[model samples]
Target chain A: LEKEIAAKDQRAHEQQKFYPDLSGEIAGAVSKRSEPNLDRDFDTLDEPVWVTVKRDLNTVGAKFGLVLFPTQGNQSLLRNWDLWGPLFICVFISLLLHSSEGKMGPHFTEVFTLTFFGACIVTLNIKLLGGTISFFQSLCVLGYCLLPPGAAAVLCKVLTFASEQSSLLFVIRLLVTSVGFVWATYASMAFLAGAQPPRRKALAIYPIFLFYFVISWMIISHSH
Target chain B: MTDLEFQSFHNQVVTNVQPIRDDDGGTTYEFQHSGDIDRVKLLDSENGTNSTPQGNKNLWSFEYYQQFFDVDTDQVMGRLLNSMVPRLKTNFIAQHIHPIPDLYGPFWICVTLIFTTGICGNLAKYIETAGSTINGHFESDFHLVTGAASAIFSYVTLVPFGLYSLLWYRKSEVQYTYLEILSAYGYSLTVFVPVSILWVIQLESVRWALIVVAVCMSGFVLAFSFWPAVRGDKKLIAFGTIVGILGLHAILAIGFKEFFFDAALQSNKFGADNADFSSGALDKALTDPAPNAALTLNDSQSKNAKGAEPKAASNKADDKESSKATANGAPVATADGGGQKDAAKV
Candidate 1:
């Protein structure tokens, strides 16, 4: 009878363990309610939904946050697509602002379209390489990842205001755009890694590398 | 049911229900289930242990600032006295004490205090400028308020995010959360409160002293918070982070000086004083009606006789002699007279 009682007590303890902690569940429920107007089926794994205004706002904030703090931003982005779309918009705006101040301002539409085409190509490459990410997700990641280059463009524009093109300015522009290009490439590659097959991930990264190289080249040449 | 089954069943029922005898002559049941717990209770339980003392729930609410004073009195006092030293211990204390992230409370408090102090500082500087000049108008109150608000917004948002990114990029092994870093940065603003008040003193030396103290306090806190976490890595990264933090502190100090302390107004006051001195002396020498009495008479004569070239020539000779006399006393007096002559000719 003593052994049986002990066994029974142990079994009860294990059963209690299976029961979710009451406090944690309550907290989760509160946070869930606090989340901005998400649909009831937001947690459904198989379905992709259109982005809502609240989600887009959150994403924009996240993207801005990431630009300021990449490590935390990266982790947050990996966990959820909170900031990617906004980051892309931010970079695009910055690029447009910079290009508008230059002699080649009339060609901005062409430049924009070309950049968009490059993003599409990179997305296509990822798809062809057996990457499982959605087209929009790839586009979002690639667009937002262009932040460094966009920042470089702004710097170049500011420098151009001081002088049209000096050797020092050229050197600075080269260094900045180069760093931005490399950063964008690395960030996009890392973001897309999970979607691409492990063995061919490196091969998948080549199009991204080419895409950023063209962007850097465009930024540098126009800056000069 | 068996004895054990009945006991389990009874426990479940007791845990799930609360009986209440209603004054309306009806029996009303209140559920005592865990799922029905209030937000405060949920926060408390999520923090893992409820044994720690809790302040009023309303303390953290922005609407109830008075309660902030009541509840966060200890933290406020601690920040004012020891600043970053005491704040750095909050992470450790949080593990045992109020499990709810206490960072938000202090963060909001710091932000509010910084902006309030900044606006006051700007007002004081405006008053000083107003008192110093006759026609000097105070800057628009709207401008001051907007400047302070925008500055606080950026400091709270962009600056911390930038620093967090830099730290994360440089020190991947560091264990601190982004929020913890932000909290430390926010708490560091306690030093700025005193600095902002000191700006009202209207002394450059006092402003400089405040800047130094603010920078030292903030830099020390940032280094102290990050050092332990990053020390295990290559010393270069730690050194770099400390240097970056110090640089950020310096930038913030300069920004405060520019925005809150009215450095531009101070320069403008000096310019106005110098202008008054030079122009006052010039006014005495050149535009004094008594000293220009002869010229005034000669000008009227010349005006009456339009073809009187001789009188005009005589007036010019008289003017030259009088200007020489004035020049003997003050060389700048001649330049002022010459400028007036040119203006009269035009």
Candidate 2:
């Protein structure tokens, strides 16, 4: 009986090696039967593109979840880095923050390229400051860290709808964006702080400060 | 013996072949060595850039952008010098930055200009406001950095893109890539880097002089460099394009001076105008010149509040007072609107 059970576990492990269940094997055999076979031989070349995109999005979403609570193991973001989250967050923020009739805000493309260029500059600063992290990894971490600011932008948008432009509203925007700036900086530092030498950590952190500061300023200055 | 050897060769060929059953229960004869090699090659071709194929690089990959930043220090310095001294014969983009334009120069030049403009504009403001009682306390406005970034970045990118599109539309003799146009525009702004630093000198005449010098230096470089691209088009349109280019360049320099360095004077004018509107002086002036019959009802109400005087004089003072309430209320609303505009400007 024990031998039979061991054989069943072996088969399950081998099957898992072939087919990855990103949602987890939580539902036992029911969900296993429902998952489409994405892991096939390359010679076939017949898998629909959406299946791969769905899988990648799942991974990206998981990383976004990790960014929310940047604890000790959040460094796993560097292990398998991707830019989709950043791109999505940037587009989200830019779209929300774009200029309209009376609301003079940053244009769409300005905010979009600003994200890429800002990421590039911040990554270069990290490399120059002697951080051991790879280029794209720094970009990935910085991009994912934009989640807080993106959220702040959304919150400010909602806040704008509720009231007229006044000092009180400005104060609220300041408070909200400051929280976002601090959160973004803290989360990114949590993920990246270990990569720098002890002496050069502050040097590496200053650009990150400016990067988030500029973003937060944009968020706060978002007026109607 | 020949018959026996031929029969043996046929038998050997049959014996070496084997039928293998695939997952779909189809049996196929395979030459094992060649099949493995073909399968590996098929996978390689299918995987594409994962195996490092040269010339066809994935555009979104990091290595693709590395080429733009491959420029050395000497190349950047050469491009900087080339941008400042406009040589009519030399096509700067084609002659200097070719094969691949270095983005490092443009990116860093814009960055340097943002900081210099922001810091110098603040310094200019400090000097202007040092003795003023109105704005006694001075806090450095960091919004200038954000404003400068957006303005400088959008100008650098959008202007070149528009020009490239226009050239493409005209079917010009020269085919300039967007990046090449962008590089030219970026280098053109290099003159402003030093000029912006000089704007801190607090002399309006000197500031305007720097603006003229910087605009002419960079504008000529832009005009001369871009002339070849526009040369083949119709004569009027071509000249118009160059004029438009210089006009836009002049606008940017003048805007930087007015908006950033000369902000105090403009704001002071707005404040004085707002004050005059609120204080009923403008209202008195308006009511004195034209006393419309509709205002007399409002006039009598104010006359009762201020005690007796001559009927016409009372009517006029009352007109001023009543108009003052309405006019003052209007300016306050406008003041709110103006404040919002100022915030938007920031």
Candidate 3:
């Protein structure tokens, strides 16, 4: 019995020595890196073939928007999606507008010319810039929705039952959604909202933005 | 410059520099030491009149990063990211990161080189058309600030350093994407937009605020980028990415529509050609005139000296107790300021 006890003690001692403590005494070393981290490590270091798999899985999870509370678990890129999504949406809106402008050629050439030229003037006057906005986010979002205009709801259902019902059909559906949103915003602005003189409209918007900025600045200044 | 100054100055630059801090603590900037040092004389004597930089923006030193860090493992992708990260310093910013003072004098030199090219290149033409006149007075001094921001570094500084940083990034835990960096570059430009206005407005209050804000935003990215965990830290980054993307969209959508209007503002004041020029050209034009403006002012002063009664008359006046001297000789300086209009002569 004593011999068996001694053997167990030896094993414990070696395990304890896995790491050193402040006093250089042997300390317990925890094994098991919580599987996700393990997967992440593999994903980052794995060969190209496996990388694609990891990337797709990650993107798919991102596509769902967010199932796992991004904050609680890992520091994955998806957590910031709330704010990111809006930025992406803005880009999409711009592209939609650009394409619509493209469609109105031949007869509406003058209108198109006026619209584009007017935009450039407004950009510089009020210090309109490119950094606070970009095209990448919108592209990514569109991809998530399975290309633009379809809003193809090819819901990437991990669950077998959901996949059986709508995955294939949704692929096309996303495209439709994009088309619908584009038309809605453009048609509303063009046909519904009567055309205001470009310069005057710009002048109007600048003040409005300035007013908002000033008020916010004031409120913030006063609060502090 | 001494290491102390380099360190203190670095505190200023990192807040304003690119590739911000790798982790939150602070950024590691590399200062590449070039042999050339501006021999500045502190004293004002016959021999003390050594060369200080002609303008405040002249570079005192320059250096580039020794290396950029990136993931180097060839292991399977999963194992590499997951496994390699464990070995990273809990302080994931490179352990041997260079301090700013070490980087700055070198950085300033590099910046100076870049600014020179940028100032001299096509950009200068455009800035001149922006109207040398604002409220009837041309701002000859504006280039003292904006010109510095736009310069393209000397080839020596721009090339090897550029390659070094790229190589460094390739070797680090996270390989930076050109697109990602470029977008960040764009955002940096936007954040910095307000600070550049300091030259235009010259308000200590507004300028300081913008400078502080610009510095904060500028360093936030690269400094944060150093850690895989931070880069991997999806929460803030993803949110930021999303916001940034959305912002891009909003800006482009609005910007395209807004561009024409902005350009139109220059018409009556600047003329048609000014709008056609790239912003770089405009910036250069503004700076190019500045050097000449100073020279003409000096020339005009010499003429005034000749036109004024000879020094003998002033001496005679002093001798007769009729000498008149003001508290300052500022009239001569005003002549210099006025000489901006004479810049067309250049």
Worst 10 residues of 1 chain B by lDDT: B18-27
Best by DockQ: 2
Model 3 C-alpha lDDT per residue in residues A1-224, reported as the tens digit of each score: 22234445555565455433322321112231112232222223336767666655555556434322212233233222223332343343333223222221112332223223333332232222111222232222222321222121111212222344233433433344444334323322222112234333433233223322221211111110
Question: On lDDT, who's better, 1 or 2?
Answer: 2
lDDT of 1 by residue, B1-346 (tens): 5878645433443333323212222222222332344444568777755442454345455334322222233443454455435344433222322222234334444545554554565557556766676555333222343445555555555545655665566555555555555555666676676667667777777876777666766566665555555566565555544554555455456556644554445435454332223222222332322223222222332232343233323342344345533542342233234333422232
Q: Which ten residues in a row have the lowest lDDT in candidate 3 chain A?
A: A215-224
**Residue-by-residue lDDT tens digits, candidate 2, B252-329:** 676577567766454444543332232233233223312221121133323322332233243434443565445434
Best by TM-score: 2
Q: Tell me the tens digit of each residue's lDDT in model 3 across B30-107.
A: 332110111221133324334432222234321112111111112112221221132323321222121111221223
Give lDDT: candidate 1, residue B344. 29
| lDDT by residue for model 1 (A183-216), tens | 8877776677778656656556656786777567
TM-score of chain B of each: 0.51, 0.66, 0.24
Pairwise DockQ winner, candidates 1 and 2: 2
Which 10 successive residues of model 1 chain A have the least lDDT summed?
A: A97-106
Estimate the TM-score of every prediction: 0.35, 0.48, 0.21
TM-score for chain B in model 1? 0.51
DockQ of 3: 0.01
